[model samples]
Target: MTHQRKQIGSGRNAIGDFAPKLAELTDDVLFEDVWNRPELSPRDRSLITVAALVAGGDSDQLRFHLKHAKDNGVTESELIEAITHLAFYAGWPKAMTGVATAKQVFTA
Candidate 1:
């Protein structure tokens, strides 16, 4: 089955003016290579990425990944469970932020 690739960010439109190289790497290396790896499905990658973003308290990135996660077949229930599970290990504040970001993504 062909997996639909989710647009993770604004791509060149967001960074190309000031950081062309970074934009290129974000598009070519990160998304094209690492994310497109065949071993792990995009859904699995979305789970891991969202969890890591929550653990890092990186809500900026979390918003995009949360939407991408849903596009990749991750349900709202699963995202809720993941954030809830991470609260203890990653800290309550981070998980809470994740939940807030998730709510926005899900509702949007």
Candidate 2:
């Protein structure tokens, strides 16, 4: 499947300045290629990405992905439920952090 390059955030632009090749790979390979695979819908990919970010306590990336998740059709209730369900396995602290991040994303 082919996809238009996604404008994820400033990180890609910053990386592109220093390492254009890496940035190309990120934009072309990761986002365009892998993320656009027809096997998974964008919403499903958002759910998986959000869960990974939440599990790893990656609030910085989580912030971006949360917005993407909502744009991809993941509902507020679904995001809350995912975080709540992950708390037991990923840790309460991480889930708590996710909740705070979610609030910021949802409110914004």
Candidate 3:
């Protein structure tokens, strides 16, 4: 399962034709190398990523990470709680958007 996730080519599948280098880097470097680093579990990384994405008001990417977070074992309530907690630090607007996006992800 770990090895399979590492070989993912979501970057390629999404934009390889227009951005080959980025695809390679996203697949080979980001996913394969960085994500596979053993220090932090994938669940930890996914949660961190979801928080950053929410804080940054990056809903586009957050959609994917929300799903990834759940796949990594983060519960729906946990995600909502995290987003709610981020409101104090990440601001109410961003947290609201995160909740909205999370709703879409979890329900779908």
Candidate 4:
């Protein structure tokens, strides 16, 4: 038996026309290859990705990942708690910003 990874076209929808190569790489390499690896489930990947974005204070990307994380079965409270916990290592300001971003995503 074999498992098939789900297909996603977020990259092309996001930036295919502006940067074809990046879009293709995002669609093929990141989403198809990296994200679909058997080792980690999509929910786990979403959590890690959200943490990275929060640590880097990448709000723009964080917005999307926040929703993505939720869609992947991560609860809103879990996400909030994760961000609150990240404050210690990732920095207070970054977590504060993450909170703001999370608030927007949660409400919207």
Candidate 5:
């Protein structure tokens, strides 16, 4: 719990009251409840989240999730393939944006 708080609230040097509660929900519900589900692996979830973020043009959040995706075993090739596949159905622009995000992720 302390470790989670330290990581999440460290940037601003304060918990901001809501930080604790946010951490609780993130730790207890977000991670433990949904992320830990056996039906989907962490890697798969990260991949999906990154893709959604890319589609939504949420680059700031996408960058974080891209790193998470890489950490969880989402390879560059796999990301490229996913974006390429998404290009057809989800629209080229969105897919292109995903490719740009992937490029940043890979370069970093």
Candidate 6:
């Protein structure tokens, strides 16, 4: 089986067909194929992904990614700096929400 198919088979069962495909794309393709590239460290990738998710106001996704960001060596201060930088461009509200979520993740 292909890497995506293997991941799909091992993943949790979902109610819809598309959800599994989406998960495979995100897990195997995005995470494995792209994030695992040698050029960019996992820490940098996590920082970029988390910042994009936060700026996009994707709270649910951000919450999950925040933890991964920490695991990938994204420090609390770096996360805060990212949010602060986004505030000027992506809006303060989104940054505020991201900051709050980061706080929870840092404390956990």
Please list the C-alpha lDDT of all candidates, in the order they appear: 0.88, 0.86, 0.89, 0.90, 0.70, 0.75
> Clashing residue pairs in candidate 6, if any?
none
Candidate numbers sorted by TM-score from highest down: 4, 3, 1, 2, 6, 5
Each candidate structure's TM-score, on Cα atoms with residue i matched to residue i, is 0.89, 0.84, 0.91, 0.93, 0.71, 0.78
Candidate 6 per-residue lDDT, tens place, 1-108, comes to: 212211122222432255777767666776667766667677777788987998899987888778777777778798889998999989999999999888887787
* Model 5 residue-pair collision total: 0
Q: CA shift at 30, candidate 4, in angstroms?
A: 0.3
Which clashing pairs does model 1 show?
Answer: none
Residue-level lDDT of model 3, residues 14-49, one tens digit each, is: 989999999989999998888888778888888899
Best model number under lDDT: 4
List the lowest-lDDT window of 10 residues for candidate 4.
1-10
TM-score for candidate 1: 0.89
User: CA RMSD for every model?
Assistant: 2.1, 3.2, 2.5, 1.9, 6.0, 5.7
Candidates 2 and 3 compared: the better one by lDDT is: 3
What lDDT score goes with residue 47 in model 4? Answer: 94
The candidate that wins on TM-score is 4
Cα error, candidate 5, residue 95 (Å): 1.5
Candidate 1 Cα RMSD (Å) = 2.1
Q: Compose the digit string of candidate 2's lDDT tens values, residues 1-108.
A: 655334343436768789888888878887777787778888889999999999999999998898888888889999999999999999999999999999998897
Q: How good is model 4 by TM-score?
A: 0.93
Weakest lDDT window of 10 consecutive positions for candidate 2: 2-11
| Residue-level lDDT tens digits of model 4 in 20-60 | 99999998999888988878877889899999999999999
State model 4's lDDT: 0.90
Candidate 6, which ten residues in sequence have the lowest lDDT sum?
Answer: 1-10
